[model samples]
Target: MSRLTAAEQKALAERVLDIESRAVSALAGRLDDSFAKACQLCLDLTGRVVVTGMGKSGHIARKIAATLASTGTPAFYMHPAEASHGDLGMITGQDLMLAVSNSGETQEVITILPLVKRMGAKLISMTGKPKSTLAKAADVHFDVSVEEEACPLNLAPTASTTATLAMGDALAVALLESRGFTAEDFALSHPSGSLGKRLLLRVADVMHSGEAIPMVTADVSLSAGLVEMSQKGLGMTAVVDQQQHILGIFTDGDLRRTLDSGVDVHKVPMAEVMHRNCKTIPVDILAAEAIHVMEEHKINGLLVINEDGVLVGALNIHDLFRAGIV
Candidate 1:
């Protein structure tokens, strides 16, 4: 190992970045009919895409497989070395093989080419050597060749690997768009992630409903509304008609205002003290949208309504926070 001055280290790092950036940029021109064919083959496949590679390429292949799977194309990584040792059984005639090899001659990957072909699986090869046996055997070839490696000695896989990863991203994104994959679809693939929480969580899933909802009739005394609010622990109560149709909402703020006006809590009706025209949301809307509504109205809670404008549920910022939608 060799130690260098801080300035020399920075300069070397910048050189490597510049080399890898240029290598990825060059791949844009290489996207042509072959790239389209590769994406189409993936799209038309009835089964999963089997991504295979060896050594460093295997790491990139695994990532590409994840991207493809998460973006709507079913895919999984199959280690080339493991494939020769019976993992090749994972590949089916309905599946497609995406092989990655910088030199286009990784022995582990090449060794399975015959079996993959015999299984009638489609093959898409990414390689620097266009004329290598792997490239020739592939149904479609992607040229990820780079002028040179970012490694000063050009003996390590640096720029080539970067280019390969970029190409894989390109393929994943192109296929994602072609398949009309939406953010909600992506969320379904990542239900434990924050984006999934925002996209899939509906107000009904988090709101207080049924007997848990705090409610008071329009003619109910303001003191009764306060009692309902206290019992439900929502800091507010809906003023509704006999049919549970929301007429207005009385919150802690409304109570403070009513008291400031010297209104007697025991005498004043909820309809007289409550806030009409309160912001309400449908029970089916995303909880994230509830946050937007609350922020827009400068309020801390919301009334969830049904299709018939009936009060179905209630939720506050605290509820959203508990549900991890905040």
Candidate 2:
């Protein structure tokens, strides 16, 4: 055996990519009424989309099922062999069956078709051979045929699998659009992920309120405000009035400025040193949005207020980081 030279290897890799790219592009022309029908079947399903296949096709089927489930379609992949072994009980008449087999005659998948049909499930097939038994048996057939595999002997399932995956993506995205699925909906399905945290976690959910908030009356001495800030460990304190209305904010930076100006910290009032027009965010906004506001203003902390302009909560850059919003 001999290894190809670097230049030869690069050329071979490019050729393979080009072949797979063309195969996926060709599927655009194959989209027809059958594709629409398949999408409609999935859209109308009240039960889960049951995806099944064998061998390499089964791998692609699992990925397709995941994509569908994440993008607002309820779906799961069932191994054909397992389905034949009483797992077929998972499928219901309200479900839609999506079967994948490049040759359209994998014995395991073919053997379970009748049982799926007898359950009155709508059948959709993805195959490289349109005339094969699996394609003919399905109520809707998606042609995933490729000109040839990227393999030298054209035996490997390369281009065909790429085409099949692309078609599956198309179906999932079409259904996603028809259902008016939003990024918030996707975030809900992925609640444990960083994107979900950014989209779903609100300001009030992670903010320090009541006794946890570092606040002082506007009439308090600057020295007292600094003590409140230090005790709260948030590096800042909100200066509020008797009615709990935010008058201003005093942070570590304001303390530094007061020291430089040679003001009497013990005698001067907090209202004299606090930033009267400091940034404030609504309690109902997303924590991600609060981070944006902090970044835009070059501030380290924010005062959360309600619609009536009463101080409700307080948060800082560290809080956002702790909440996985930063």
Candidate 3:
């Protein structure tokens, strides 16, 4: 069914990528005062940005709306064809409409312009034809015109859609900086994602606390510390003073070393075998930071301390894995 050889197919694929890349690159040099004004309009809006388009442009519009919403701007996509069927009610007077159409003359998109104006909403249009109805009617216009389509026949939307998506990204990043959007803010919008877990999960949230903590008094026998570690399943036991302040930690590695020296586990005290001045983390630090501490010290676990230097909890690499932080 195919007439082209393998080499011809590869050439076609490369040409598509080349044309699309150039289309997006050209948009970088065309940025003007209108781009800034567009960002400002979105930043200053009291309500959301309502993006709408038809056909292939609609797909790009939906992505742009999602990007805006996730990057500290309130925005959503509205189907242009469905707008006339009562979906226009989603728009309020405080909202701004971002309409996308390569030709700027899409009938469904243009039909809602009069209604949007009567409702007192501002308009921003992304289009190839600056003089087309949709572009001329907007309060601000972004020209996404390209040299030509990447389609071999120069008819498909290949290049224009890529240019429009790049322009939308430019608007989003500019607005993100102007709004002072931080990673923590992004975590709030993506609470179910891995970044949210890294940013929002705290040491206290994952560390074993109360009776579950593997702890032993410094005067306890090394054998007794081993029993505590086995019971708590944390691979190590914290050695604490009577006031609950951490003294040191005794791990399985310490056990092997003590055994090699022919020391009796039943006779040696935890204070004699424990590692002194071991790493400890604050309870309020991020769980991600806990991982960093473990890696920095080349240890498998850490003791958690409160503001008063009291050992309150403990956690190991296994805990990080269970919490999806690893």
Number of the predicted model whose lDDT against the real structure is largest: 3
Superposing all C-alpha atoms, what RMSD in Å does each candidate have to the true structure? 2.6, 2.2, 2.1
Q: Clash pairs of candidate 1?
A: none
Candidate rank order under lDDT: 3, 1, 2
| Residue-pair clashes, model 2 | 0
Query: Candidate 3: which stretches are off by over 4 Å?
Result: 321-326
Assess the local accuracy of residue 157 in candidate 1 as a C-alpha lDDT between 0 and 100.
94
TM-scores of the models, in the order given: 0.89, 0.92, 0.92
The per-residue C-alpha lDDT of model 3 at residue 83 equals 97
Output the lDDT of residue 139, model 3.
95
* lDDT score, candidate 3: 0.94
Relative to the unseen true structure, what is the C-alpha lDDT of residue 204 in candidate 3, on a scale of 0 to 100?
A: 95
* Collision pairs in model 3: none
Q: After superposition, how far is residue 141 of candidate 1 from its true place, in Å?
A: 1.5
TM-score of 1: 0.89
The runs of at least 3 residues in candidate 2 whose Cα sits more than 4 Å from the true structure, single-residue gaps closed, are 307-309
lDDT of each: 0.93, 0.93, 0.94
Error of 1 at 163 (Å): 0.6
